[model samples]
Target: MAAPLDLDQLQTFIAIADTGSFTRAAEEVHRTQSAVSMQMRRLEERIGKQLFEKDGRVNRLSEDGERLLAYARRMLRLNRETIAAFDDRRLEGHVRIGTPDDYADRFLPEIMARFARSNPRVELSVICEPTVNLVEQIRRGTLDLALVTHDDEKGQSEVVRHEPLLWVASSNHAVHEEEVLPLAVGRPTCVWRRAAIDMLDQMERDYRVLFTSWSATVIIASVISGLAVSVLPECALRPGMRVLGESDGFGTLPDCRIGLMRGHTGQPAIVEALARHVSESLDNITLPASEEAGMFDFAAMMAMRPRRHRPNMMPGW
Candidate 1:
């Protein structure tokens, strides 16, 4: 395999190309003239490309040098971004993060894996609960941060992602066609449940609550068993489930606004680290090309992403 390009050498090369003189370029980088010359020699040998050509008494970039200069600047800029991402403190110690049961299943795998890989010494504590309880914990200082369903009426949060709120039913059954629709929904505090009820009421569609739970597993079980239809975000759709659309008289529901709620305490390094990771992961989360497919190619979709490392699956929700 080719050896990795040296960042320091690239820095020096960029300096020489900019200053057009070894002595001044050395002064620009705070290196001795001989040292700068040595670095350039090594850089040329490393790439087998002569980056500088003599022009009168000054140094001018060869065609390869001009091409490499752009790449060098980009690499250094990325290095700065990478360093800035970690908060300015030792990122260690335990951080507590909460999310609803549904979000835990749909998003935590990538969030937890990426955070743990980046900050191995920083311990993580996770809680799976309803968004109401998660919001309360943030206020009470019992949690460092939370991934929540954003509601501006309730409080402030950083909205990170939005997903379509979909009416869903079991693919194998006709439960949705019942004269009085039986519905499995979350506790009243769930924004998704509220949107589902409000839109149904607006359409004057008759419905009855058959089951209520905060657990995604229970809700999905109710859905897959064809006992009742439910509303869910795009990520929560699973195999054996089908979306109910306008053709089925299911009106449009409000989007699920996923937010990051930080605790009242000023941001700490570890907390900020996890918060950034969660936002980036969720932002990367994508919907299927067709919702009707009812299947997410999880592995195939995420395989192309580069991960520094991954431990075992996150501690159970």
Candidate 2:
């Protein structure tokens, strides 16, 4: 008869995989480093497969370890769901989550507040990064969930919300009319940046990249300050910004999509619950029935603001 696998050891294994160091894994799992080491030793013996290997100063997963990771995540997720199905108390635990600065500005506040109220015991550890970095963290088992910009070429994600991508410039400035147009955009890997450049190239428009950054604040600031023009989501329409259209020589842009990605660490109940909240929260972000014919006004959405304090850097939603 086959021996049963140990759930405690599996949990410890996942911690080590996430941290990439026995010491850090020990801190995360609340066990001594030696104790964590012993658990891995036993885990390897139980499965008769070497799981870890030495890499410079940190531990790296061996080929077999990578295979086990998926199974371990699945088992742990199932166990959590089973417990949650029967537990009488409110759901609890930590959720390591992330999103790019753009979404962080628009979606996170309400989602955070709603999630906290419903699951007060669930601790939220958040990070703000670009989609590439966020997806990398998910692959490394560091992030439980992330709201990201969805692009097929960058990373695969379950798209949750779609918003029209629009070009905008300062309502009071003529920056967009510069013969050699100055533009502020995200890093080279950004899909929005690629789209802007591609359209310009097709139009044979003279242009120059005046600023490149992964930060939405920096890009948006450049536009508001009349330093450069930029493409932004509908929700990013600030008070001084005006949407550009065909008459302005800027072509219509496709919809920008928001997606969710998860890590192998599998906090399923917590992650899925948060994912639902994220989707529902984005549904509240609405634009006028038609694009505004005048300078974009953020105050028009004031009625949509939640009856709560809005965080700095948060967008009007």
Candidate 3:
């Protein structure tokens, strides 16, 4: 008889692949790092294939791991649906969902698509804006729900994912090697922009803002063309960019908290339902740690991108 796949191990595998580190995976699953490591070993043995490979200090998904990721996501989603079919309550209402363009590009489509399938009556209207503006909109009840990137540890926002800020530049461009670092920054209110500048100031490093915009694509384009470097969450690392670490002489940056904020107190059920769905969907997101490698499907991300030009800044969001 063939060895059966353990759902727990499969979950662990997805977490590791998603987070790009066993340590982060352990945090995700609420297990010790050693325990996560053990689970991976057992899972690989059962599958009879290596699932991850070492890339510098991080463990990247192997080709087999990448292939398994697709299956794992579908299986887990189906598994949740199968189990919820018996007792799942129908969720219905208008949910005004808002997020920065970058996150909307990376994770929103999948989340919204799945939510729509599960709750056909739930009307979802999305807004893409800067985090600072989005938070204000949420507070004023202009938006029912928002996902934002924040550095506040004391805030009441329900955190979805937490990761450190990473210094990123195009792999083809050696922007970081310049004496006076050029920066492709967001608007003045951007948390990532603030964090990056503060770190540079503390380090007494010289930097010049080459470009500032609310559009993430513009910033990425600047970096890709060797115009400047930018700080972003680990999840934003794409195929063309590289992550700069301490060894690269960049000062450490503060961690970012991506969280959900509720603006309207009314319709608790719908808000909670969407909030729960967002949490579950985000939990499965796997961002590449650096440019030379990533387990995520960039093609899927490209496909999910909306046709029209949308404001696309907000690093942590």
Candidate 4:
């Protein structure tokens, strides 16, 4: 019989992929860096496939590793479901949750669906809003839990993930090279907007707010049409966008931390149960470094271009 894939090893693999750093992954798994490294090697041997490759100092998932990710997530979900099914407590209560709109499509559906399946009696009320609004609502006790973005390093809350804030533009846009950067921003309270403006000010770079909206999609659309460049979480980046980095003469932006925030009062059992599910679901979510160029028609953007422009000096958004 083939050697069974160990759950511990798979969990460690997921930690590494989620954080994109072995040291962070080790911290997450409560293991030494060397121990984690050894586990990865052993896992690769058991599977008869190399799982990771070095990207600079970071280990990016290899092609085989990417292929394993889907199966791993499904298997882990099944494991969790089985365990939940055996639990004696059947939780049933209304849990009001809030999240930034950007994450609504990415994680909310799967998380809520899983929770609904396991706790059929529980009622979930999900509200999609900006992080700022969610934070306030959570503080005011209008929300039981919220997924928020903060810059706190001392870990004042339950940190979910650290997403790099990226400057993105149309694939064929060379706006980064222009003297006055045209910025497509969201609401004034948007975290990315604040960070982008602050970074530009600190760098003494000239920038003009060419467009503003409350929607990330609108900002992204403006970017796709080469109207302006905008800052977004790395995971929010799609195929038609280009992510600007150090090589592109862009200043570094702070990492936006996605964390769980709860109301001042103690959480009810059902709320606590939902929070745990949210943590597990989010922990398993690993975003691709950059989507494939062909995923979105590179040709469509090119053909619609009103003017000749140079290729962006960064990877797919």
> Against the unseen true structure, what C-alpha lDDT does each candidate score?
0.77, 0.77, 0.75, 0.75
Q: Which digits, one per residue and each the tens of the lDDT, describe model 3 over residues 1-317?
A: 98668888889887766565677678899999888888889888988898877665555677898788778867877776665555557666788988987688888977897787667777999999988788889879888889888647447477777666678877786889899999999988788999999999998889999899988888878877778999876556566776676667887676777889998768888888788788767766664435423533334333232221111111110
Task: Give the alpha carbon lDDT tens digit for every residue of 114-216 in model 1.
Answer: 7776676678889998888988898899999999888857756888776777888988999999999999999887788889999989999999999999888
RMSD per prediction, one decimal?
Answer: 12.8, 16.7, 9.9, 8.6
Q: For candidate 4, lDDT tens digit of each residue in 81-130? A: 77877777777667899887777777887789888877887788899887
Span of 10 residues, lowest total lDDT, candidate 1? 308-317
Instruction: Candidate 3: list runs displaced more than 4 Å.
Output: 1-80, 83-89, 153-156, 288-317
- Please provide TM-scores, in order, for all candidate models, with all chains considered together: 0.66, 0.64, 0.67, 0.68
- Number of the top-ranking candidate, with lDDT as the measure: 2
Candidate 4: how large is its RMSD? Answer: 8.6
Error of 3 at 232 (Å): 0.8
Prediction 1 TM-score vs. true: 0.66
Which portions of model 2 show Cα errors greater than 4 Å?
1-87, 287-317
Error of 3 at 9 (Å): 14
lDDT of 1: 0.77
How well is each residue in 10-51 modelled by candidate 2, as lDDT tens digits? 998876765556777788889898888789889999999988
Q: Give the distance in Å from residue 77's predicted Cα in candidate 1 to where it truly belongs.
A: 12
92 Cα displacement, candidate 1 (Å): 1.3
Better of 1 and 4 by lDDT: 1
Per-model tally of clashing residue pairs: 0, 0, 2, 0
